[model samples]
Target: MRSLLSKVAVGLVFVFGGGLWAASAVADDVAHKVVIQVSTDDERTQKIALNNAVNIQKSLGVDEVKIEIVAYGPGLGLMTTAGKQSQRVADLVLQDITFSACNNTIKKITKKKGAAPKLVEGVGIVDSGAVRIIELQQQGYAYIRP
Candidate 1:
């Protein structure tokens, strides 16, 4: 009886302790880099993407999150200083989230509008938004177009 009780106790401890370790292991998986592709000018989807990015940072903790909002084509407007989402997006920019404006789109807009498109302060300009998405994917950053 004594030996049987000791074995059961050991089994129970192993199972319970293993569960604890699994939970903490999940916590350790918080660090991840993700790139959000924005090519459409759809207002609804644009807002959803930004909200999701912010939610991701909040839920995972900002330090553990590397989010990039890549704007190209018509989506470039979302990153423009003239964007209607200016206030909310600017606030997120202050939170250190990555915002990249596509150089190609800027040039196109400049030609059409006869002026350079303005980007939010602190946003980086990249060669092509599509190219950047491929680049990030090559570097193992998950692509999410939320």
Candidate 2:
């Protein structure tokens, strides 16, 4: 009887402890990361990208989703002070959505226009938007282009 009880105890420990560990693993996986690319100057496309980010955050719960939007080429305009979606960008920044503007594109525009474009208040500058997107993808972020 003593030996039987010891075996039962060991079996219970493996079953319950393993179950607890599995549950913890699932909870840890609740958070998801996504990166969005905006390469167009179109106002509609820019708004769609922002909408996609918001929708993902809402579907996943604010605390469970990490979102980044990388804008380059003509899309860099989306991160500029005079952008049509500038106010929306500011609001989303408060919600923890990251906005990345390409420095290379900025430089090109600056040289052509004779002045650097003014970025929105919360925009971050990345050396290259394409590279940023690749890095984010390597780090396991899902990518979306709208």
Candidate 3:
């Protein structure tokens, strides 16, 4: 009977202790977060920012990272439908990456061009890209400018 009880205790420990270990492992695997800023009009700079985001997502498993790219000023063009990177942006959006366009920049462009720029599908609009970057940083997201 004592031997039976010892075996039972060992089984319980393996079950319960293993559960706790798994839970702590999941907790330690907290998703990595980052907010990338792109305020340059240079196409090369914009592509570099996109590449940085992709590389980070790849280094960490896609499901283990959250990434947001904020574009304002001259960089706002990168999020527009007519932008050279529009197709790539769309592809990245499908992979769970976020793209933000500044409404303030859109308004300025509208006033200058008589119409607001058309954003690529899945692009989110923020009141200001700078403010969005600050908000993300306050929320513990690492900031990147690439």
| lDDT (Cα, tens digit) per residue for candidate 2, span 15-125 | 999999999777556479899999999999999999999999999999898899999999999999899999999999999999999999999999999999999898999
The candidate 2 region of ten consecutive residues with least summed lDDT is: 24-33
- Model 3 poorest 10 in a row by lDDT: 24-33
lDDT of 3 by residue, 1-146 (tens): 99999999999999999999999767646478899999999999999999999999999989888999999999999999999999999999999999999999999999999999999999999999999999999877999998
> Using Cα atoms with residue i matched to residue i, what is each candidate's TM-score against the true structure?
0.77, 0.80, 0.80
74-93 per-residue lDDT for model 1 (tens digits):
99989888988767778888
- State the displacement of the C-alpha of residue 109, model 2, in Å, after optimal TM-score superposition: 0.6
> Which order, best to worst by TM-score?
2, 3, 1
Candidate 1 lands at a TM-score of 0.77
> Local error of candidate 1 at 135, Å?
0.6
Full-model lDDT, candidate 2: 0.94
Residue pairs with colliding backbones in model 2 are none
